[model samples]
Target: MNKKRLLAAAMSVLVAGSMLLAGCGQKDVKQAGSKPEGAAYKFRLAESNPAEHPVTLGDKKFAELVKERSNGRITIDVFSGAQLGEEKAVLEQVQLGAIEFTRVSASPLGEFNKQMSVFSLPYLFDSEEHMWKFLKGEMGEKMLNDLQPSRMKGLAYYTGGARSFYSVKPLTGIDSLKGLKIRVMQNKINMDMVAALGGSATPMPAGEIFSALQTGVIDGAENNYPTFVAQNHYQSAKHYILDAHQRIPEVLLISKVIWDKLSPEDQKLIKQAALDSVDYQRDIWAKTEKEAEAKVRDAGVTITEVKDLKPWQAAVKPVIDKYSADFKEALDGIDKARK
Candidate 1:
């Protein structure tokens, strides 16, 4: 077989095996009912973010909400900071019902669902509101439900905020990125986005970025304000530019193994709790961005906001065109959401 077909076939086998292992038996949706005395099931939810990160806070809120909604019968033990394992490993365990839950950036999720790459594509959404409108709308719902075949059921999406470019030196515009080695998630789309912007894309693990910046292993990296500051990456890469490239949403995923085994009533409650937590998480995120930016400035970081992003957008047009060919329908759905 050719490489593409072989890869697709391998993915199919992997997903199919996972489904059988996870007992993928989804039932028709039922109307929400009052919380029951519930089967006292204790499950695990893993997160890689720091304990104080908004994503972790959202997980805590979801756990709290689930306990309250279930009257404490269904307990979720939340593991923060990769106490379990890295995201890909936790995801594997989750698929096999070894772990019950996880919250992750939609970027890694592209490994499971290629359509998810749309999120990693630069400048896909015009604004944060536009991104949400697409995510919370029909196409978004379809994407969440689509995870079933992968032995994953996406419960809801939380705001991860926009990722921007930060460098050891100041970034003036689209031209500023030329030939700089920028760290990106080890994903093709992300790499392409950086390359399209005229930078050499260096894919590396999140854990290694600080050292990479400090030791000149990389020239800079892109991420949200809080992450840039929290990692003390500011000390190494002092220039912060608000190109706001990718506003990739965070995904809350449950094991289809665990999900299918749940009583439909329990499933409804879990979904409700997760959806409710989205608003709470977004509120925390807004306050956090401001707080992180202020603190970075206080630490003597040069922060630049790109009000006119036309040049930056234009630079990544090829990345957009390439994905558009493969994901035209998906791209159109997002465009529709813009209205």
Candidate 2:
């Protein structure tokens, strides 16, 4: 009986030791990612791009990193393909704190922060490297900080390559675009840019473009390569002119309402995650653009490269002049950014 009692006591002690070791392991994992004594945070990110889009993939990567770095303290849920609503409507929701985040083009974002329209200015970026150098510098930081008053915070920028003209007929030069009715975003800058380039700018909804092109309601529309192929716009419009106009950066925005609620440490974690996602998205953008260009050509679209950009650049001079007053600071940044 004494021997049996001794064995039972030894076994009980060993079990308790193992249980304590297991608890310590859990504590270490929790400490790596947990916020200090707070409830878990869950955020929703809205994206209008398609599910397979690089933007969407980047959004997922951001969420994944946040999860890993936070040690499960915070989780970000992404809603893609405009699952929330249109950009303008969703932006309003973000301001109201009904939504937490969104990925928006600099064009529609102009409605929230007017200076953002500067990104839509034609011929602003000489090359991708030039644009990125500016974006990763103080000027871009100011642009992001500019959103605070509007109750949003700019997190990061992702590329969608450059916009160009696509038509059922060839757009070989500035003269070739004359009298052609081209679809532009429903924005003053975009409209004026197209008009200055000699195309009759018709601002319309993106969804209407395919049928409109088919029925000859409009001559052509302009967008990036992925959009041109994904929407089957290549089926209706065979000529894609690579003028590389308007290389706008897409911005990731967070609701200030939600941001204010986060712990400083958590905010830092999220911001770093967002910045990391930018590189991932850019790589995806390059790959997607190359594949998109190939697919559209396989579908028999004629892709035209602009040999002389001097003529194209000269055409939008009036547009730069017209918005010179309101966006002067932004315009100046563009020139300075080139350096």
Candidate 3:
């Protein structure tokens, strides 16, 4: 072969090799960005309520938002009424990346992150406005960020409704609560608050509550009007006392593992959807409370709105002082929020 012809053949071979490598890189990129087949990204979202509850409404709305935003690239399977497990169990599943999402009351989260106890503090928030202000303010953002190290990402705060007292016997004043058995969330602050109010706190699961109330295992329980009515606790306990003591907020969370796997665009979509759903759920919650009150009233339950919370506040002040040391930052944040 001549020298010029040999050089031409070598150049042609190099060009062909370059084209093959470029083609492979393009194929890899396409594959990496492609959607999975058969199912969209399967996400298991669990909650601590039945499908008919407002919690389920929020879950369903979130799923619809994700599906719509992603054009059906993400599909969330919602397990309500503790089907996946209790709130604590589901939260652990989320931390381990075994579950994609969950809605939990901040009470149980206090065990994992003590800072969350701020939400458990009795009478910390003076009103619903104050509660929302603190939740959407800088303090709320800080509290939400506090979950990152625990491998959970907070999406939004849903209204759990104001905590109140209910009993088989009418509780007209703080004095009437003395020696009564009241079911509370398994949190130290809650136990202390019940004790301060002169009632014996019985920590139990929501699923076991109706049976407990029926069999006289517990004299009564405290929850929002909607919960008291929805759970049919009105049938077992005829008195609904509106103490409205602690306005505990329910937290919606996503697994950090799942969040990290998502594209930035997808993350933004999910976050926005969550925030929007909060507003929607809050509206539904208020209406639900009214309906619940009416329903229970019709069911022969006596509903009493406390004329003053000063006595109740005075009773639980010690609990605040005790838990305050561990939650100094949160207390400061709440104070700043008030200002």
* TM, every model: 0.88, 0.86, 0.88
Superior by lDDT: candidate 1 or candidate 2: 1
Model 1, residue 222: distance off in Å is 0.5
TM-score of 3: 0.88
The global C-alpha lDDT for each of the candidates, from Candidate 1 onward, is 0.84, 0.82, 0.81
- Tens-place lDDT digits, model 3, residues 109-179: 88777788789888898789888888998879788878989999999899888888999888788888999
Query: Mind giving the per-residue lDDT tens digits that candidate 2 earns over 1-339?
Result: 256744553564355335434544655435533454344556678887778888788888888998898778677889987887767767777775667779988888887789898888898889999899889988888999899999999999988789999999886777888989999876789999888888899987666788999999999999999888767899989998999988989899898876786677877988999999999999998998899988998999988898998988888988877787888877777789776
Between candidates 1 and 2, the one scoring higher on TM-score is 1
Off by over 4 Å in 1: 1-36
Displacement of residue 119 (Cα, Å) in model 3 is 0.7
Off by over 4 Å in 3: 1-39
Query: How do the residues 1-339 of candidate 1 rate in per-residue lDDT, one tens digit apiece?
Result: 357745554574466456443442222212112335534566779898878888899999999999998878677889997887777666777776677899988888888778777899998888999999998888898999999998999999999899999999779887889999999886799999999999999988777898999899999999999788767899889898989999999999999987887787899899999999999999998998899989999999887889898898888999988878878877889989876
Candidate 3 yields a Cα-based lDDT of 0.81
Steric overlap count per candidate: 0, 1, 1
- For residue 325, model 2's alpha carbon misses the true position, in angstroms, by 2.8
